[model samples]
Target: MVTAIVLAAGNSLRMGTQNKLLLPFAGTTVIAAVVEQIVKAGLQELIVVTGNEPDLVHQALIHLPVKLVHNAGYGTGMTGSIQTGIQSAKGNGYMICLGDMVLITAQQYESLNTTFEKAYHRDKTCICLPRFNGVKGNPVIFSSAYKNAILQHDDPEGCKAIIQANNPHIVWVEMDDDAVLRDMDYPEDYAALINL
Candidate 1:
């Protein structure tokens, strides 16, 4: 089993007063869209970390088959949310997904999962990351071997440090879609998503 950890706990400081996760995209909330893609990819287990507006975020995903884990330390940074989600993860491998990344598709999620499956079959401890063009993208999947390392991570850079430290274990899956590289962070990003 593979768990999809959707990090939706950010305060959305860049979006001014609006929570980007709650914003409407493709006729649904941003977080819902992200989770929908995860579900569409055939992933059954999902862990959503909520902090900023836990109630609202929960409301957004109330009908979905997902477990909501509140992160009290979310104000610190993304690492806290990642840790919170990992604590509830029950899969052999986990994928770290961001809620604000509304453009990612179910096909992309499956692609990453496929790569991870191949790596797991080889009995290799690896991290599967999607790459758009030459840029790395979200929903990074990693074997359970790094769960403890992710929990112990305290850097401000989030889990990128773990990826950097384990570069030799990374399996970069090249993707032709640019949606893998886009995320709704600012107002302009939201506008662009709307336009798309």
Candidate 2:
């Protein structure tokens, strides 16, 4: 059972007053598009970590088959929301996804999952990450062995520290698509995605 944790707790300060995750994108809400990709990937479990406008985010994803986990410490950073979702993760490995990365497709997620399964079968401690032209991207899959380490993380840098510290365990899955590297952080970013 592989779980996908959608991190949607940020305040979206760069987007002015609007919640970026709830913004319309590709005929659906940003977060919904992300969740739909996860679901289409055939992941066994889905957990959405909500903060900022949790109610609005919830409303955007209410129809989806997902478990909502609220993070009161969201103002702290992304790590808190990740820890919140980790608490409910039942899979031997979990994928960390960003809510604003609406362009990532189900095929891309499935590619990550496929790579993760291969690496996990070879070594359970393996961490599978998608990369495009050598640049790392979102929806990274980490073995449950690092759950405790992630929970103990206090740095503002979030999981990047763990990945950086454990480079030997990383299996970089190269992808042809650039969607993994795209995320809406500002109004212009959202506009660009919409125009694309």
lDDT: which candidate is best? Answer: 2
True-structure RMSD, every candidate: 1.0, 0.9
- What lDDT does the true structure give each of the candidates? 0.89, 0.90
lDDT of 2 by residue, 1-196 (tens): 6789999999999999988898888888999989998988888899999989899899998888999999998999999999999999999888999999988888889988888888898888899989999888988999999999999999854788899898999999888988989988989999999998
Clashing pairs in 1: none
Q: After superposition, how far is residue 23 of candidate 1 from its true place, in Å?
A: 0.7
| Number of colliding residue pairs in each model | 0, 0
lDDT of 1 at 126: 88
Q: Where's the lowest-lDDT run of ten residues in candidate 2?
A: 155-164
